[model samples]
Every structure is written in structure tokens, then in C-alpha cells.
Target: MGLRPQLMDSTRSQDQDQNSTQDATALIQQLEQDRAWLLEQIDRGRWQEFRLDLAALERELGQLLQRASEHFSSGSE
Candidate 1:
């Protein structure tokens, strides 16, 4: 017999879970890289530029954390 409906649904759900976890991880990594880049700019004594970059990074980090929280909460439900 062919695969049951429940099995197919479960497989698709697992695929979605994996993809979302990967996306969240990638976003986290990107934010970390942005932070490192900002630190490097600061080390170069670009205070003004660093300030702008830091502000932008802070906003981006907030958004990422919100997304991660939503993802985890939804996954748990």
C-alpha cells in the first residue's frame, strides 16, 4: 500500500521544522557577523560611523530576537 496520510503529513511537518530552524540559525549567525564588523570599525577609530552602525545593528538584533522567539513559541505549540 501507499504511504498513509498521517505519515505524509508528519514528514512534511518535519521538513518545515528543519527549514525554519536553519533559517533562525542563519539569522543569528548574520547578526553575530554584523556585531564583529561593527567592532572592527570601532577598532579602526571610526567613532561616528561606528555609532551609526551600532544603532542599525541594535535594531536588527531586536528584530532577529523577536523572530527567534516567535519561531520557538510556535514550534513548541
Candidate 2:
């Protein structure tokens, strides 16, 4: 019984980790897509709003990537 509970906990932890990884990947893809769209808008000279939005997006994307890197690396260790 004790060993079974430990196994269950380990499985749950793995599921949570997998979900987190998937969520992070999806977020990164969406952010990249948004960046591309914003860039196209900026290129067309829709300057002010899109540029600001892009800057904010870049910052968020950077932070998220850093966090994801840390999370995965820590998991490996």
C-alpha cells in the first residue's frame, strides 16, 4: 500500500509536468505568431500601436522562454 501511493504520486507529477510543457509550447507558438503579425503591421507603417504591442510581446516571450528553459533543465537534473 505504501509503495502504491508513491507510484500514484509519481504518475500524477509526471502528468502535471507533461501538461506544463505542452502549455508552454503552445504559448510560445502563439507568441511567435503574434510577433509575425505585428511585424507585418509595422512594415506597412502602422507604426505606433503595433510597435508598442510588439515590444511588449517580445518582453513577455523572452521571460516565458527563460522560465521554460529553467523548468525543463531543472526537471532533467
Candidate 2 positional error at 11, Å: 0.5
Give the range of the ten consecutive residues with the poorest summed lDDT in model 1: 41-50
- Report the error of model 2 at residue 37, Å: 0.5
Checking candidate 1 for backbone clashes, the offending pairs are none
Residue-by-residue lDDT tens digits, candidate 1, 1-77: 46698899999999998888778777767876776776677567777746777767766776776677677668756
lDDT of 1: 0.74
lDDT scores of the candidates, listed in order: 0.74, 0.74
Error of 2 at 31 (Å): 0.4
Please, what are the lDDT tens digits per residue for candidate 2 over residues 4-67? 9999999999899888877876776676677677667766777675677766776777677667
Model 2 clashing residue pairs (backbone) = none
TM-score of every model? 0.58, 0.66
Query: Could you give me the TM-score of model 1 versus the true structure?
Result: 0.58
